[model samples]
Target: MKTLKEQFDILSDGAVDLLPQEDFIRKLERSIATGTPLRAKLGLDPSRPDIHIGHAVVLNKLRQFQDLGHTVVLIIGDFTAMIGDPTGKSKTRPALTLDETRENGKTYVEQAAKILDMSRTEVVYNSQWLDSMSFREVITLSAKYTVAQLLERDDFTKRYRSGEPISVHEFLYPLSQAYDSVAVRSDVELGGTDQKFNLLVGREIMKAYGQEPQCILTMPILEGTDGVEKMSKSLDNYIALTDSAKDMFGKTMSIPDSLIARYYRYACFAGGEDVARMESELAAGTLHPRTAKVQVSGSLVDRYHGEGAGKEALDEFERVFVKKDIPDVIEETVLDGTSLDIVTILTTTSMAQSKSEARRLIQQGGVSIDGTKITDPAALIDLQAPVILRVGKLRFLRISGR
Candidate 1:
């Protein structure tokens, strides 16, 4: 069993805030002495079923707690999903049906299993308890917090000041989320920085219910591959957990050099000392950003995939991008000997979104056929033999004429 200090050191790494830090240390100490695992709660909004490295920031922290022999309470927000979490939203969020909510939650646990220990972890659906509450019980739960307090939350305040509509149910969203801590008896709740308000509310709600207030730990929001916005699927700036090993490595490499330290720590790398050392080396002009990015990318790929897959991805990346060599898994598409528009072929091969985009790519010197650069979007080429179709970087297709 890990000592309290050892556990704290690991848990605090990359965390943005550990509210009531003293209380967390005390709980950790008690757990170590009594061999009773602290219940670390993390509520998942099933509305977003897919998780990226950004989401992994919190999941990685949970993994640390699991490593320290702590209990993980993965609260699937099926009940709250119907209500929709109003965190960081500018406008009212559209609610999902119970069926939609439940459907999304199914794969959520499976994806989470990639990071959490399923056998030791306890998965619970909020609907199980939230649905059984009487109106009076809910009213009593509501009595715990005030409207003024809820309005003080960042999103509500911004929405109100901007003259946007604030649904009454949106106010209850935090209360419902808070109630999860009460139901699960969470000793510590982990979330991204944006979720601080809700996490703090859970602490207060737990006190109101005559339980020990759960400590809140918020992790930093990971920047996307673009290095500008938060990693999000809506923005297409996310690397999905299910991405191919090569794609994942390639995406990690695409992140700005400035984010190398963050990606190394928050994405998957476990050693805080090592991440710090790497950052120090970069700052001291001892380590190049490109080389550091390769390490970060390799670690991320190796974590999700395997050592072999990680090596393959690293080699493929170096070969395709550095050595100007082709990848191993170029798709072989058999097509009849037919004349095809360059734009049409590019779009058909999923290299670009539309003909206009394909044309733009061609004009930008990003489209090639059989290693030959084709700058003319309107050019039609007759496919007579197998030829490799390349688009920008990281996309390839071998078109064969039959």
Candidate 2:
């Protein structure tokens, strides 16, 4: 078993904030002395179907706890997701149906398995207890926290001052998420910085219930490829865990040079010491940004894909992108007509969602045929000969006449 200091160092390496650090240290000390593992809880509301590298920031931290021989209690917020967390939202979010939340939760667990040891991890649905609670029981639980206190949350406070609609059920989100920690008797809770309000409420609710309050750890939010906004699928700036090895590598390479260290620290498998050393070398110009980015991108691809997938992805990337050579394996599409307009060709092959989008791509010089830019959407393609279609930077399609 690792000592308290060793465990603390490893667990707190990439964390943004460890509330009541002394308390966490004491908890770690007690757990180590008692030969008992701590229950580290992480509540995930499957608000979206996809899990991206942004979400991996916290999961990776949870994995560190698992590595330290602690029990990881992964709480699927099936019940609370319906209420929708109001954190960082200017307005109340649309509530999802129970069916939607459950289906999304399944995908969440499956993707999380890539990081967590699923066999040893204890996965529970919050609906188990939240659903069973009577109205009176809920009322009694609600009385534990006051409305004034709930309004103290930044989003709630801003919405209240700005005259935005704040639904009554929205208040239940944090309260219900707090009850998750109570339900599982968690010793530690992991969340992103935005979730600090919710995690702290878990600590308070546990105390009110006469249980030992769980210590909360917040991980920093990862920046997307744009390096401006937080990684999000809605913004189309995210790297999904489900992306193919080549797409993952290509996307990673697109990030600005400034984000290389940040990505290495939070997203990659590099330890704290290694990350620091890399940062130093980068500052001293001993390590080139492109070289560092290549390594970081490859590491991420290897982690998501299998063992040798990174090398394969890197080789393909160099062949197609660096050398300006067409990929050896391009998706093929056969058309019924011998000739078609560029707009029709784009939409027919599912490259563009709509004709307007195809026209826009053409106007922006993003669409090319046989390595020649197609500026006019009305341009006709003579598909009698196989034409290589390139869209934007990475997408490619081989079109041929039937």
Candidate 3:
């Protein structure tokens, strides 16, 4: 129902800052005229099993193309994960073993499918093509880009100045990623702003192969829970897409109030006048940020899980966290008769990371037993009765008697 440029703008949300707009428009016009949807490709290095909302920002662009009757090819960088992406790393990321890579890739596809329609999407592993390149071919591919250009990338520049060891194989990473575009003959490639350097490399490589360069669309990076750094698993600041609805809602609520609008506009499907109104409402002090965040949380949870689950999650949050009432369907965990420290119980049940962390949490007035704050880390937890264990302001665990 939208024009080519209009659809492009809609997908980009006016955040696209790629150069050479004319070339991008020309390619898009050609695709529109030919009634061929652009071949949009996004590559992911599945070094981690979980995908976050940050990754979904690009995936949402791909979905727009799909809805507009285009082809989206998702490249699972199984081959590249072995070497790891050095895009913004100060030090090299340790390579994942073949087995680990495979396992992560499987989980990546399942989680990514929450945003992308796998039925309409073509999933590819770069290893199929990258592994086939001969030594001569590899050299030929690497010859297109100079080492100086490689060092120009932000991470490489920082690492070079800091005297961090930049491995030779890391240099090949961008080239291998660029080759994916050439292999797929992609009409467009989508990535976060940090990946613009590598995505542009794809454009150059495509041109060298006597093919029209794919148009690059770079999106603004979504900040993690910390609101100051990029969302990443390594930083322990990401909210995994696979998190339960309650967990997702709670994490979303924990984000700084300032980040709510951006998350709504970019991460969620909120757009156009709706987004404008939300922003205005915030500025006018009409809508409370907490309520707005709850809406954002529900929208995101509905996107990954379902509307029913999202509503249920909200209900659970109100019942347990707001009204201070115990959940009806408490999980019953039958434990063996053992003398366990309360902190140990919290850690063992994943309420906290370790006994020390649990103790800190309790000392901060963040831990509760049966709706009462218990600051004693050395407190004994008897398995003779069921008790509700609360951690911080959100998580709850139901512990039952042996």
lDDT of 3 by residue, 1-402 (tens): 568778768766745665557777786787788887778899999898899999988888788889888899999999989998898778988878867887899998998889888888999999899989999999999999999988889889888998999999999999999999999988888899988998989989999888989888888899998898999887877888888887888788889988998888778867767878888998999999988998888888888888677788889889877897776676656556555778778877877877777888888999887878887888887667777877777667778655
| Cα displacement (Å) at residue 268, model 3 | 1.1
Q: On a 0 to 100 scale, what is the lDDT of residue 174 in model 1?
A: 96
Give Cα-based local distance difference scores for all models: 0.88, 0.92, 0.84
Over 1-402, each residue of candidate 1 has an lDDT whose tens digit, in order, gives 977778888888778899899999999989988899999999988887787878788987898899888999999999999998888899989989878888889988888888899988999999999989999999999999999999998889999999999998899899999999999999999999999999999999999999999999999998899999989987878998888888899988898889999888788655788988998999999999999988888888888887778888989998998899998788788665577888878777778888888888998999888789998888987787678898877778888665
Q: What tens digits encode model 2's per-residue C-alpha lDDT throughout 56-108?
A: 99998888888989999999998898999999999989989989999999999
What are the runs in model 2 whose C-alpha is more than 4 Å off?
333-360, 377-386, 400-402
Arranged by lDDT, best first = 2, 1, 3
Candidate 1 TM-score, C-alpha based: 0.88
Model 1 residue 69 lDDT? 88
Better of 2 and 3 by lDDT: 2
Model 1 ranges with Cα > 4 A deviation: 132-134, 333-392, 399-402
Q: Which has the better TM-score: candidate 1, or candidate 2? A: 2
Residue range with the least summed lDDT across 10 consecutive positions in model 2: 264-273
